[model samples]
Target: MRQALRQLAGRVWWYPHDEDPDNIQGGVAVISDPAGSVVVDAGNSPSTARRIQAAIEAAGLPAARRLIYTHHHWDHVWGACAWPEVEIIGHRAGARILEVEAQRSWSHHYLRAEVEANPRLGPSFRGRAWAMPSWEGFTVVPPHTEFDDDLTLPGGVEVRHVGGQHAEDSTVVAVPDAGVLLLGDCFYSPPLHLRQAGDGYAADLVDRLMSEYPEGRYDWFVDSHSPPRSRQSLRDLIVSG
Candidate 1:
């Protein structure tokens, strides 16, 4: 439940939940322009999404005009329902994955039961502070826009289907004007094996960026589960992975 928000670059903000082993929440990024704002990866649930929404308002930005999902993971897509009015965008594969998840009612129930069974989740998830989002009547709000490769938003924010070791539908969003990149759990934290896309593709993306920006064009690289990482830090991860 503990979340913190900070500015990473001009008109770009980072909101990350403090690292908690038992109950993890996805981090998010907000990119704003006079036209509107884009929210990258809504958090894990309604409560977390509400906090993100509040943070955006507090930062004096407009309500999110669009939401970009990096993949189809429940932690990333489930919160789309919270901002139904905003246009949701994601990889075509991710959109299909979300439809499948919407039908997996049993999976949602199982997750809740698992959290309740684990004592480590007591304070944050099982206790009074927070609870697993009720799945009874749960439904997904699928992404309205899907792309095969890459798409650019109004403010030079680019979302590319840069598949990675994380998932086949993984996306990498870049706000070039702000020198910020958001890599949703793709090449960041690893079991390395979880990546459905080969490591080579992931490496290629990093290599291209590195070559294109010798002096570090991107100041911050964000993952859904962690804080903003430096350009070199992300490069190190890509190399090591």
Candidate 2:
């Protein structure tokens, strides 16, 4: 599927997630400035990454100089290798997780064996992997730079480690100048494939996120798998539910 980049703010552009036959790709955000573009998350595979790259080029945006991961999930970080020249950044814990993943073999047979060994493994992910046409060039690329709590890159892009129920390494990217927040799945419930208990949201984490970057702080909130919503809308969804 050819995904088109949609502008969320003056300097921010994102494409929605694509559910292809082989891979269920996550949404990707691009923050462009005179310096260069900073991609929020790499997609599901190299092909997905290329689609993102193509969209950026088509839009005449600056080439991505850096790639920032929201977490260590396969759908979010597997495309890191595709942007070899871009510096990859992520939370320290996420980097560690990716490091371990990088050591494992990702062949289709190996993945199938893993799924067989652990039924709790993501069934949706497993099914998609089984449908993939090829696993060629598929490898986990650990972040080159790791930060603990928060880091602000050039052009006022702020990255914060706001670990949540979905993943402990969950992070949020904010463009203060643009009034846009790139929430890479941090607000989502725990993976349904895990059959996790409870409501699937860490109330404390949600409170922390709101306390830090509260409503009215950002005009647009972009989740990895959902369409952009107003800050108040997201706050209501997470806070009231």
Candidate 3:
């Protein structure tokens, strides 16, 4: 039960989903510069979106002018409905996945299942029922701009489509100046060493990441659910995987 925005790098920040049990485990990242801020991933609900927005404002940073969806998971992109004006960015396949999930009312069914699975959180989240935003009221808001290959941001940051083992639309964002690379659920850590993409894993994805981001290429490496690591550590994980 914690809610705090952590500054990871000079201009990078992370909002750990702690206090809100319903939105637990879905963290959000933000990369800010003079131009504006780029949000790595949105959380599971509008309340989470508002919290991230407040954190950004409290830090005296600029508005979240750009959003990068790491993948099509509900926890990652569901918060976009709160800010329809922002320019969302992600791989084309990611947009397609969102569309399918929206049509099927994914969030409602998913939350219900989670309650049935975990009696602890099933009781309530922040004194409320463990429920997500209404599927009808929620929209999958596809990326305003979609990319097939890699897209270089205004500040030399690169968002490359490296879907191999994770979701086919999985993207790895690299901040050249900051020497930080963000891997969004492409590589699962710990006991669950396999990729968590519902679509299944792609064996060569790790090899591709290794070749693209060798040692010394990045100083800090961040994944969707794990703590940040050094360049060598990340590279080794890929190799060992």
**Most accurate candidate by TM-score:** 2
- The best candidate in terms of lDDT: 2
TM-score-wise, the better of 2 and 3 is: 2
Task: State model 2's lDDT.
Answer: 0.83
35-138: candidate 1 lDDT, tens digit per residue: 77899987777667778998888878878999999888767766677786788999999888888877754344555675678755443333212334465434
TM-score, model 2 to reference = 0.91
lDDT to native, each model: 0.73, 0.83, 0.71
Give candidate 1 misplaced runs (Cα > 4 Å): 106-108, 112-133, 188-205, 212-214, 236-241
lDDT of 2 by residue, 1-241 (tens): 7889988888999888865534567789999987889999998778778989999999999999999999998888888888999999999999988989899877777767877887677576574474356877767899999999999998889999888778899999999888887888886788766545566555566556667766666688788876787867776777676
**Per-residue CA lDDT of candidate 3, range 129-237, in tens?**
2335344566667788999998998877689887754567888888876767788887643112232435333336654665677666556778766567776676676
TM-score against native, each model: 0.81, 0.91, 0.77
Point out the worst 10-residue segment of candidate 3 by lDDT.
Answer: 188-197
